[model samples]
Target chain A: MAGYSNDHIASLVRPDQVHRDVYEDPDLFDLEMDRIFGRSWVYVGHESQVPEPGDFFCTRVGLQPVVMSRHSDGTVYVVYNRCAHRGVKVVNEECGNVGRFMCMYHGWTYDTNGDLDFVTQSEGYPDLEFDKLEHGMGRVARWESHHGFVFANLSPDGPGLREWLGENSDFLDDVAVSAPDGEVEVTGGVHRYLYHGNWKMQVENLIDMYHPAYSHESSSAKGGQQFSRREGDKGGIQFFEKRGKVKSMDGLGTHALPNGHTWQGGLPPVENMSEDHRAYVALLEEKHGPNRTREILIKKRHNVIFYPNMAMQELNPHIRVIRPLAVDRTEIFIYPVKLKGAPEKMFRDQLINLNRTHSPTSLVQTDDVEAFTRAQEGMMTSGNEWVLLARTGPQESLESGRIRTTGTSEEGMRNHYRAWLEYMCADRPE
Target chain B: MTKNNRSGDNQSAFGELLFVREVEQFLFYEVGLLDDRRFEDWTDLFTEDGYYWAPAEINQPDPASGVSLFFDDVPMMRIRFARLRHPRVHSQIPPSRTSHSISNVTAKRSGTGDRVEVEARFQMLDYRPGHDQRAFGGKYEYVLSRGDGGRFRIASKKAVIINCDDVHLPVAVPF
Candidate 1:
């Protein structure tokens, strides 16, 4: 492999193309963990996951183990999961309420807010100057929350969470307001699946509307018709026209914002035949009134990619977290998002729909994973070194500093590569 | 809960033995349909309201509470099998060949009804042409009802695998 300098890395990504090595090289993958994921505001768990004091959730930011813990003062702290003493991983279980984090190796303990609380045999460390704050599990450089959705940045120097979020914040706002209680929570258990492909493949695929009609033909257009990925939905996305030609998603328009954020225009609506939807609408009307409720029901974005690590869909209301294990392996976790004050049946329907769409055995996502695996295999050919992202359509630059292009265009992905280059070429973060 | 089967004679010892053998045969035949790739016929063994559930959590009470690996009602099964049979199903281009084996079978009447609750352990070894062969094993809990011809029609079938919550690759075929 070539030693990737900033200039060489910049050369690899053109405005419309990228080299295959970025997805296949282990060295570059490690560099990205440090340069891109290491500096970005990677999403941790939601505020609801650690609702009570001492509640904790363990997860990864790039390859580093971190814990999101709720302290007695009602603050969430993102701290390194490693023991301050011997580098042993402090939290072993996925999540639990711990009164205090204690290292099993030598009995060093830290407070729920990650301050050093106790240390066994303090006399042994007399030769060394040990301060409580300096010696406790080091916190991430910065962390912030928007609508109870928490994100932590490993590097302190960067745009604040709100500035980085930009127009994407409105999407979360829409989600929160759609709920009768004006909030959302990550309630349902997670669905984790693995794919033998680069993490970028999954991120790129979510925004690539052009491939759906062809790639998902078997799942949606088997008999030149469509099937909703739910139990009792009245209709579904039609991949084929009545005359048997493929339908076009170009009207759905993809919006590209700053900081690698992109979202496709809402999918064509499928009327829900279930009574839960009616109850949900009624509750929203009770809270926000009829006219506002009508506006709230209109979904503006299909899937919102919070680049580098997470993507979310307002349609089914779920978040997908991308964890890269290697250059060729990635694990994805899908968590169902519950709109607060919605009908009980509505949340149940959400879980049921995720089973068909996001689960490992999902009728929809399995085909996607297949395409990703095949793309990984296909990129190994030595003939072509570049993967194309040249597709474009008539686009409008919005006042909000976003580009709106035909949904089928590759603008969303091209936008992602632009942000990718900026992060990869920046000087190493502290 | 329908009582369409042979009379109270099943209460006798030898008759119970005969009943167990019959259930074992039905299970063997049911899985044989899957091995032969007769999905349409396999689905026929279900009553109109019958469902197949593979929960992601241990002893998951219902599909509504959390995500499930699979929970297919008749309509869902139809769509799933239709996609599986589609000519360009890329995931199944080299179609998986599964050999399912079930043993340690037990069957008994529940709640003063002819409704037989059957339990068994199963291991399905699946192989696709150039991919790694995989084994999936779990305990099966089935609620059976007697339909026409006194044959067992599954009212509900639940398979709780040991690693139901483990991160898995794409699984096209049903377990």
Candidate 2:
């Protein structure tokens, strides 16, 4: 058995260095489920998804299957989606409006709040001493919302949602509150995708602006028609082909704010876009007015990988949920949000854009999927013992609970590795 | 005998005019266009304002408020077709080949003109280089309109996938 001492694991994580086994280890994955995912605030689903009283949506928090339901009193509840009797999953469907959830196996019924309401054979269990109050569905330790997005933390003693979010809350507010009505609703339905890579790889890829110009070259080259001429004419291919050549792909650099928040700015500048994009901008201004609309639209961001599992992109209006199934398999759920009060045509336009570009059927997304899958397969080989995070080294700056590096630096990856090491090495709290 | 003959003749004539066989053939041709990657030709078949929609849920409309898997208009469709055929688009190096089949054509007359509504069941086998072929089966709802020169423009094309909500890999090509 490969046993790791606490000191040994902690010593492996330096500000700029980390062990490769952290990404490949099975024990570390389980430990993470307990330490990081088990304690941190994980996003569930948006409240608008379960607007109605009896509406419910099933999701996974770490490895635990959870159900977020709206009670008759209008309060939302997050409970384990398992039947107390035999641990059978109570809700199997993605979403539905059920007055009460009844276990099909044993006929045990629970109300929308996960309160046990009825049992099939009450008299048969005379001496079982099953208290409905005690046996109510196991609720998450903490459930809260920030701008209509619901999140739950598995640890009851951990930080509050706002405290946990810290400075990053501002970015969340910017995304949610900058809308015209100062509110945004989930317009497009959720789109889920799977990836055959380590969950961390997906998270790291989100802020790693370096890969898009290369990984998404095919997508940008074809889909980015207006920019094609500029990229082609911009001297040698090396200038345009570098990983972070495009301004939009600059997240790979070490530019980030306090509270572990970081983002790449601006879109790939394409010809004729200065005018054509203005039309889209005018539409946004019409909806959100010039000021707030400018705040939401003008800020260019490709992806914001919230530590642990959520990857959000304002440009795409989609939030992706990362669920690590195994060391090699990760499930990604993509939920597309529509700005409330926006024109129907605008939504249609976004849908078409995403479907043509991001959908599994899209040319851009497939290349990314293939690359990640291949990377996972390759890591299984014995040739490479460790993955490298030693990109910028001594140049990285650590300050105010955030790690920063050059705009083209790999400091974000180093930060994540540091956090991962902490989670893996920390002793289990008694 | 003359009156009875006239009634039977009218019934047969109207049935022939419905042209269910011709409608079926039209549907098959439409599927063939997509399967063969005749995207530009497919674009030619749509009216200027024609749309393609796939609901995220079973019966949710109003794509603005409710989520939709796809809701594309003419310009959007054109852009998609362009991307699919782009040379540098890496995902299409070993382009996806799809085989689709359509069945069950039903036509009825609406208020102004004849409206044809048909249900098409399709099983698409998508193959790419180094990746195992994936199979997806779904039902499609097409609303066709009679355009100029006896051509047909699709008013609406909705595909209801069986696994709409499942975590899927990036879908690069059009389904």
Candidate 3:
């Protein structure tokens, strides 16, 4: 809105790199909230979050405050949080079951599917141009779910969630089908952090496997010591650290997909995975054949970026959502994913791993936070105008409708910016 | 008969007072060790099978199912301490400077004479080189037990942080 022309914006992004202003200029940031996030399919809460009728979870699509609610008829709705009367947010709380979202300002109530259920003084006001049916809660343009993960798009005319997801849908299927019953529930409260960096920094770091080796050296070293002991030697000392450690290019590769979704695969199996896999395979053998079960069990990938704002880690068992507060400040919400029909100990182990690796007090996240903060600081420098995305690789390879690169190549980041540039270059209203 | 009874009661009362004093001194010494960054000495204050926990949510009773800010037994604690001291732990590259102030201390005997339940409110000011100084206030719930040489050692320490459910800053060190 602050007067950056489309031609100038298009010039900022090249095939292999992006200009620094993409992360800095407040004008571009505001425009992005309108163009890219305003049109793209952004991840809403999971279906399991609002399992029962009338349950709701408050979240955001771009900078707009929205709520994902479940109706009595088993349908999910993503509605603008604003009340029809005074434009105030209808739901004040984070998440709970509510019969109706009654605006505190004037007591106007809207139903779970975001329909105006009641009015404070219906009889007092004459129905002129405004009708009760017309004044129902404002809804998002489109809402859809893939493998129980709901996504909302703010713009009315665009690709459906499936078309946009494209090849990335398989990665999501891998996560959901890994559950013995082909379902996952969002259990345990979300771990939220206010990061002092850009939202893209977090998204970029999702598949950036190169940084962990340097950033998390201390944690990996200590983990090695703890996991070096024999299994069952000490209670609660699983080879978690060893499983989480980054091995040197052990069958590692990155896959780039349409819509900027990229996945990093080939992580070494976590210790004791075979035992869990055997159990899962046995349970799923009746419904799914041994081959399918093997595929589900052996699908150990670190992370897959859903672009725009969300990333899901299959092995670590968590989904991370980024809410961009400002050009500089962002809030990261991490939710633990519980694979249904798996061993209860599996859920407990995943929770423990989250506590160890992702929590604010954890050694790994602390290092990441520090590095991101430093990156934010460095971006403000006048010395450099561009941030390099061209990592050393022998030209990206296109195989079977997917781009493949070395384990540590920056091709994934380049894929992200390409989609970003496309979205930002779209026609704007003003 | 009357004189012996009175004398015996007085000795028992004196012994209870001495136990409380020892518990207070032990807690204070532990705080000093943490402030001094003497992690090795700090960990030594715990009993062999003791626990160090900081519940992720308020009043989280157990760490088995729910996530925790910290839920470390001995080995995990060792890893945490070693990571803090490791050179490549970039988060602690400059290392955090902290001063812990604990007050409102209260100690009482639990089920048996060997165990004591101590509660204290604490405020810690932590500063890293570039980051702004942060004040973390919490309540410490400690279950202490008498170990060898009649010295009090922590059996469990649970740090309950106030107004920090959705933590924004890095809790790099123990609260």
CA lDDT, every prediction? 0.87, 0.69, 0.80
- For candidate 2, the per-residue lDDT at B17 reads 66
Deviation in Å, model 1, residue A5 alpha carbon: 0.9
How displaced is residue A370 in candidate 2, in Å? Answer: 2.1
Whichever of 1 and 2 has more TM-score, that candidate is: 1
**A-chain TM-score of every model:** 0.97, 0.85, 0.91
As for DockQ, the candidate ahead, 1 or 2, is: 1
Locate the minimum summed-lDDT window of 10 residues in model 3 chain A: A228-237
Candidate 2 wrong stretches, greater than 4 Å = A1-27, A222-261, A266-302, A338-352, A393-399, B1-18, B62-65, B108-115, B145-155
- lDDT of candidate 2 over A1-430, digit per residue (tens): 3476777668656675555566677876777787778877888988988999999999999889999999999999999998888888998887899999998898899999888878787799878777765676778888999888888988787578888676567667777654545566764666656777778877777666566666766445424432221211332123253454455433334545433446554444333433434555676687667887656755454456667888677665777788889777788777777666554555555564556445555545666777778777776677755666656533545565655555556677766665566566656665
Q: Say which candidate scores most in DockQ.
A: 1
Worst 10 residues of 3 chain B by lDDT: B163-172
Candidate 3 structure quality by residue, lDDT tens digits, A259-367? 8888887544445544655575588876688888766667655678888999988755899998998888888888999889987776776787787777888757778
In model 1, the clashing pairs are: none
Q: Candidate 1 chain B, which ten residues in sequence have the lowest lDDT sum? A: B1-10
Listed in order, the DockQ scores are 0.62, 0.37, 0.58
lDDT of 1 by residue, A76-109 (tens): 9999998888899988888889899999899999
The C-alpha local distance difference test score for the whole of candidate 1 amounts to 0.87
Retained true contacts (fraction), each candidate? 0.73, 0.56, 0.67
